[model samples]
Target chain A: MKIIARVLIILSAALLVVGATMAFASSASSGSGGIGPGRDGFERRPPAGAAEGSRPPGFLPGGAFGRGEGRGDHEGGRGMPAAFELLKNLVIIAVIIAISTLISRLTDGLRPQRR
Target chain B: MKPEHRTYIRARSNLLIDVATFIAFLIATAPRLSGIGIHEWLGIAFAAAIIVHLLLHWQWIVALSKTMLRKARASSRLGYLLNLALFIDVTLLTFTGLMISEVALPLFGLRLPRGFLWRGLHSTTSNIAVLLIGLHLALHWQWVLKTTARIFGLVRPTAKPRQEVSQ
Candidate 1:
């Protein structure tokens, strides 16, 4: 059991290091162009014929739903609907929990007899 | 108490930890399911509880190596192995959670990384962790029940609590 525990710990540490490295590399490469709260540098300006200052067809600005579209509302981008985005996030969280729980059970079942 | 008795007590304690962890997980995830911020708050509370839980079992961890070296008990060994994995999984989940841009709640003005990879990994690991936790619970169903009955005073010394209560 100790050996197994040690092995698992080592493996987990390695994975964490790898994950961190990958994340760092990606961030370094993508710079400010990554998808997130801040504006990506690579994001292009609205194309011709697109309503000036109007959020693109699907994209809703972060504060859109909370404050309602004000007079300054103009720039729009193509993005998932707010409701959809929220739902997607919720679904992802739920699925992750479900999977972890399942794996835990499988591991428990593999325990040897204690008596 | 005899060695067996001591073993039973430790096992029972471990079982209680599992149940608490499971409940915490449920509360933490429920908000996400309903698409509400409540889940995020609950998750933070859960994380705090988990930290406490780990601290409480620190001694067992210290003795883990000695115990494993002294005995060839398979079930006990396997339990330890699973626990080790669980520790890792939970740690990753917590870290990744802090990486996501979304704030369920902010702490001391601290914010999680808003990078693309952080978000992606956080999402992926979260799913895997959930499934693993479910399996952990199912595998320890007996321990869960035993600990639950003990907590509720449903476990009797001489007979099953249900029978004693009814009589």
Candidate 2:
């Protein structure tokens, strides 16, 4: 029973972290975050048909986000991305605790048997 | 070898690993501190080392948690809780680090959203975590110094350097 509990704890921790990443990844790809023909993941589409190089597309060229910086959302400091990041961070800490606990358990087996 | 010798060796080994992991963690977690891909891989390495560190101290942690519930000393309880918080913060650091990751996770094709929100949180939380760790170390400052001294063979040490007499 104890072993089962330990396994469950480890499993949950890994799942929490992995699940958050998957959710974030899906959300990103679902948006304009794809790599298609000279388009990096974070390209902010110009309004309908705006002239090239007319306005700064939120991110500076060779700036923070994946590809040069798309529109406003692609900027590293606003909207869904930030919100998602905060959410994912909560899961991240849980996952770390779980993994660390599991590892600690393994080390217990190696200790010199004490009376 | 005598049991005392074994104890000393074990203590020294744990200390060495702890110090090494800490140095690596500082390098890995520092944003853009090591120039590009270097920092990313170091982050992954930090994750691996952290688990090992926990494992090395598992016995004490387990013993303390059990005792804390039954009215163990306040200091011991504080140590357990402090360590717990540190580990959790570390997990957060790793998790958010991945989301806004420009290097490590990206190679595995794990592309997260484009925003500095995770990045910003990562920076802020890390700063807080570092401060907490400083306190944690301060609580154990004497032990750290003595252990380092013992490892260098400059001082003779007991199992705990200073064994606590039971009340």
Candidate 3:
């Protein structure tokens, strides 16, 4: 029962965040002649270039969101190769861990010794 | 189970799940290699894993919350703040992913409006997540190494829980 309550609390918090985001987006869009219920009670037409089946350029070969969009060896949307990006992320993680270890050691060194 | 056995089991479980979560994060970060379908599905799975991670550490969360403003160690306070930021960033990342979902939501016959805003937010949040997750793992690096050594039998498991176990 306690576990259930905790799960419920988590779900409620997540829902609140989602709800707030949607509400803020709706209001923002409504103010800017956005996509909301039209005078005819239909969704106002999707914004220009926000058309259906359009995908943004991405590093992934099959594009970012949709399936079967692009499926061959092609350069990433970014000028660099995809492998380089992967290496970059890995290197960043390694560097962060190394620095953290150094800081942990430094803090321990600064602390008073326990006899 | 004996208390020592229980402690060992818990340590092992924590190590396995944390490793899995780290791998999932890595794969999800690289949609280019995993493809869009795997990336989206893995992201949804990652969200579930994160909740489980928190559930496993619920006691620490409660205890820390009770004393965060008072007697908690400076490192613990810093960790708590980092975790809070991670939770918020990941929440936004998952929510925005769902909002801009093209493959997963459509499978359920629920097609949300595709907006540039959702897409942009998803990208931004994911970028922030990389840094946050890096810090999170770094903070726990000692625990991870020690746990792995114990689990692999290079070092015997201790009966007493370490101070850092609260994290």
Q: Highest lDDT: which candidate? A: 3
Residue A54 CA displacement from its true place in model 1, Å: 19
Residue pairs in collision within model 2: A44-A70, A44-A71, A76-B116
lDDT of 1 by residue, B123-157 (tens): 55555666566455544555556656765679643
Q: Write the per-residue lDDT of candidate 3 for residues B78-106, one digit (tens) a residue.
A: 99999988888888889888876768888
lDDT of each: 0.50, 0.57, 0.75
After best superposition, candidate 3 residue B5: deviation in angstroms? 1.8
Worst ten in a row by lDDT for model 1 chain B:
B158-167
User: Which of the CAPRI classes, incorrect, acceptable, medium or high, describes model 1?
Assistant: incorrect
lDDT (C-alpha) at residue A50 in model 2: 65
Better structure of 2 and 3 per lDDT: 3
Candidate 3 clashing pairs, residues 3+ apart or interchain? none
Model 2 C-alpha lDDT per residue in residues A31-84, reported as the tens digit of each score: 543232112223344466666465345444343433423223212343334334
Candidate achieving the largest TM-score = 3
Worst 10 residues of 2 chain B by lDDT: B158-167
Instruction: Compute each candidate's TM-score over C-alphas.
Output: 0.52, 0.61, 0.83
Chain B TM (all candidates)? 0.67, 0.86, 0.96
- List, residue by residue over B94-161, the lDDT tens digit for candidate 2: 76666667777778887755544455546665766655555565556556677788888888766443
How well is each residue in A1-115 modelled by candidate 1, as lDDT tens digits? 8656655655566477657655665565565542332332113334567653554221244412232211111111123243443344345545655665676678779978698
* i-RMS, each model, one decimal: 10.3, 12.1, 6.0
The C-alpha stretches of model 2 lying farther than 4 A from their native spots are A1-115, B159-167
